[model samples]
Target chain A: MEEISFASQLLQYTITGITIGSIYAMVAIGFNVIYNVTEAINFAQGEFVMLGGLVMVLFRVTLNIPVVISFPLTIMVVTVVGVLLDRLVIRPIRKPSVLSMIIATIGAAFFIKGAAMFIWGKDPFDLPPFTGRNPINFLGAVILPQSLWVVGFLVAVVITLTLFFDRTILGKALRACAVNPNASSLVGINVQYMILVSFAMSAAIGAVGGIVITPISLMEYDRGAMLAVKGFAACVLGGMGSFYGAVMGGLIIGLIESLGAGLISSGYKDAFALLVLLFVLFLKPSGLFGSAEISKIRKF
Target chain B: MKLPAAREALPSGRTCGECAHCSSSSGIRFETGRDLPVKKSKNSLHLIGFGLGLLLLPWLAGHVELLGHYMDVMVFVGIYSILTISLCLLMGYAGQISLGHASFFGIGAYVSGVMTTRYGVNPWLCIPIGMGVCAIVAFVVGAPSLKLRGHYLAMATLAFCIIVTIVFNENVELTGGPDGLAFIPGLSVMGHPLDSIAKYYYLVWGFVLVTLLLSLNIIRSRIGRAMRSIHGSELAASTMGVNVSKYKIVVFVYSAALASVGGSLYAHYLNFLSPASFDLFVSIKLLIMIILGGMHSLWGAVVGAVLITFLNYEWLHYFEEAEGMIYGLIILVIMIFLPGGLVSIPGKVRSLWAK
Candidate 1:
């Protein structure tokens, strides 16, 4: 192996970090949406991502469908699954406590993972890169084309989500519901519908993340739990309901993980991110961008 | 249960309503009440009977060849019983959920395993050392985490569990990595090594009995009252002079210590230590056990541990590939239909029948 310069190594780590961070950011955003409206952190969010990749593989590889068709189909299928989860599992509980809902989501996550294992047979599946597998060399570092796809999708999703939240009436309605459901219902907003929409949108976002990252990172049945944990760490680090916070938290976590892997023992890579999570939680639960009042939202 | 009612019915010179902490709606009035001698005697009789039964269980199992297979399962049930009971104290009494309890269990196992295997330390010394380490780690994790309400605290513990698991798998020098450490020495008392299954059965269940007694004493004490108050309402608990955070942390530490003790026994019994044995799934399994049996009831924890252990070892094994599916389905069905858990089913049925 050629000995690379320290600067080049740092640059390479940054690129890899951003790519993975983008995925985490997407997952975090998914968590933020449902949490904002329902105050339930859907543990199945990562499973949706896993489903996205695996379902896409099923459509494209097994069924010989085109990538373009399979991608959207995967997102749609996952979105429907998310909606059904809310309808069947979350909605039926008349007096849903936060603890109960959390456990319920965990059960859903396990169910989805088990179903995935049965369907996918526990092996990792790969997707062909959108363009090619060739690495583009920079001044001293190299980057994959798939990484560009990941970064690009993340940027697009963020912009779209920002626009959806700010400029659209439906987005405003969702935001209103999130802020105060009783007030929103009093003002004639359908809080239930908004919650359903949030779940669907969150699942769709997670699916996009899963689909794009599959080419770079292979998909497996049990991978959802780890992704969910990392995403949750990102969500907590970013401030639970803040969108921009989620993005920033994801990037910071990604950078920490990649840099730690590059500079220290790769074996302890995950520990670095977890340490940051613990520190942030212990010292400042509100996170960098979150308001102090956000920490006081503990209902039960 | 009836003793509290009997105490409430006893008319003393003082009015029970005079006590500020007494809630009239709960039907249990607290006064300077005298102990019911008859009730005490009856309880002691029941206790003696239960103790006798527990003592005779191993002897009966030894004589019956058909029951030999269950000796190992019963030993594990004792281990899980400790974990579930501790979880019950935290979740049922304090209204806190921990998704990473397996980390404490794993820490205890590793600490004892490493000490016994690497340093050749006595198993007796290792158990307490493991409990101490687990208690400190629990304190550090719980101090910050207990401040967060509900799901966030759960997530924090989950993150901590993930980090611990990673460390177990990555730090090959300390933990034997994914392959794990083996040849851990069995536990002994006064150098009499508990090598046989029946001996381990007695040893584990003996600890279980002690733990249950301790837990029962705590639950019936003032500290338990404060914990129950916190579960009802933290703000109310604080207003009533219950140091809410202090009790939460103390209970969390106690629970971790119990799990650690169980882990030490597990490591010695299995004569091996692996990261896989104490993964996130183990924590979830423990949670499910407590939830299924009845999170609030002490005996419920024991029942849950035994039933779930049987389900995992016997029932689920038959399904093989569908294990996760069945496990997930059971949790969902229970949470949906019987949120009060198996312990409450009898009461629920009685109420329904009355209606």
Candidate 2:
């Protein structure tokens, strides 16, 4: 094996960290979307990403479909899955408590993971890079095209979501519902509709993350739980429900993990992210951007 | 079954209400001062019958063709029953869920496995050492996580569990990595080693009975009522002078210690230790067992553990690929249709009959 320069190694780790961090950011965003409206963490959020990658593989590799066509198709399928989860598992409970809802989502997560395994088997599947496998050299370091794609997709998602939430009527309605569901309902916004939309939007985001990250890290059935944990750590660190915080948290966690893997023992890479999460949760439960008063008022 | 009728009389949905039969709406409240003797005598009778059944089980298994191969499985049922029962006390009674409970179990197994196999320490001594480690770990973990409300404990414990599992896999010099530690010594009574499956079964179930007794006593104590009060409403519990945080942490530590004991038994009985045995799935499986059997009831824990163990060992063996799907399906179906769990089946049947 050829030894690489320290500068190149440092740059390489930073790029890898940012790319992975963006994926965590996407997962945190999905968590925020669902949590903002429903106040329940969709534990199946990672499964949506897994489904996205696996389904993308089925469409792109097996069917020989173009990336443009398969991308939307994968998102749509995962969105349908999200809708089914809300309808079948969540809606049936007439009165839901925080504990029960958590249990229900966990059950749904397990079910989705199991179903994915049955469908795709135990093997990890890979997707071709959006462009090609060619590495771009910059500042004495090599970067994969897929990493750029992942980072670019995250930026696009943030912009689109900002516009949708800020300027669009539907997005404003969702924000209103999130603020006060009963009052929003009285004011002519359908809270149920907002709930459904949040699930759908979050699932789509998860799918996009899965699609972009699959080439860099192979997608497998069991990987969802670990990803979900890392993403959740990001959410808690950045302040749950804050989009800006989620992005920041995701990037920080990603960088720490990448640098830890590169410089420290690689075996404990996942632990570094989790330890940060625990420390953040212990020291400051409200997170970096979340308000303690607001958290106190919220039920779960 | 009679107790569930009283449970049904409570006005609240999931929260145990202060019904007429009992002043305190405790989780799995079986006997009250009003009808203490009848309920107490009946419980004692059931206990005697269960003890007899357990004693005869191995003998029956040896004689009956259909039950011949189930002796080993029954030992696992006993070990898992201890785990589920401890979780029931924490989750059902105290109303705190620890999603990373398998970590304590892993600690117990690894400590015992390492001490006996590598250092040649006595297996019995290792059990308490493992419990001590678990207690300290649980205190540190619970002190921070339990201070917050909602799913923080669940998430924190889960992270802790994952880190522990990773440590078990990566620290090859100590844990033997993914290959795990083998050739663990078995438990011995006086000088005689518990080598036979039947002997191991008896030893495991003996521990289960003691655990069940201890848990039952805790439930009936004043501390138990305080725990139930906290479960009903944390704010209300505090106003009632219950040191809510203290109780939660104490219960968390107690449950962790019990889990360690269970893990130690598992290691000694199986004579091996593997990281996979104490991974995330095992933790979830323990949760599923408690939920399936009936979270609130001790009998429910035992029933859930036995039934799930049977399914894993006997029934689900044929459907290996569908195992995860089936476990998930069971959780969904049970939570949706019968959240009260299998222990509620008799009450449901009685209600239907009355209707």
Q: Per-residue lDDT of A229-293 in model 1, one digit per residue for the tens?
A: 78888888898889999999999999999999999889888778778887888888888888888
Q: What DockQ, between 0 and 1, does each candidate earn?
A: 0.52, 0.56
Instruction: For each candidate, give its TM-score against the true structure.
Output: 0.92, 0.94
Q: Residue by residue across B90-164, what tens digits does model 2's lDDT show?
A: 988788977888889899889899989999999999999999999999999889989876666678888999999
Give the per-residue lDDT digits (tens) of candidate 2, residues A1-300: 145578789988999999999999999999999999988888788888888899999999999899999999999999999899888988886667666677778888898988888888999998899999999999788899999899999999999999999999999999997788999999999888899999999999999999999999989998888888899999999999899999999999999999999999899999999999999999998899888887887777
User: Candidate 2, clashing residue pairs?
Assistant: none
TM-score of chain A for the candidates in order shown: 0.96, 0.97
Q: Which candidate number would show the highest DockQ if scored against the true structure?
A: 2
Q: What's the true lDDT of residue A179 in model 1? A: 81
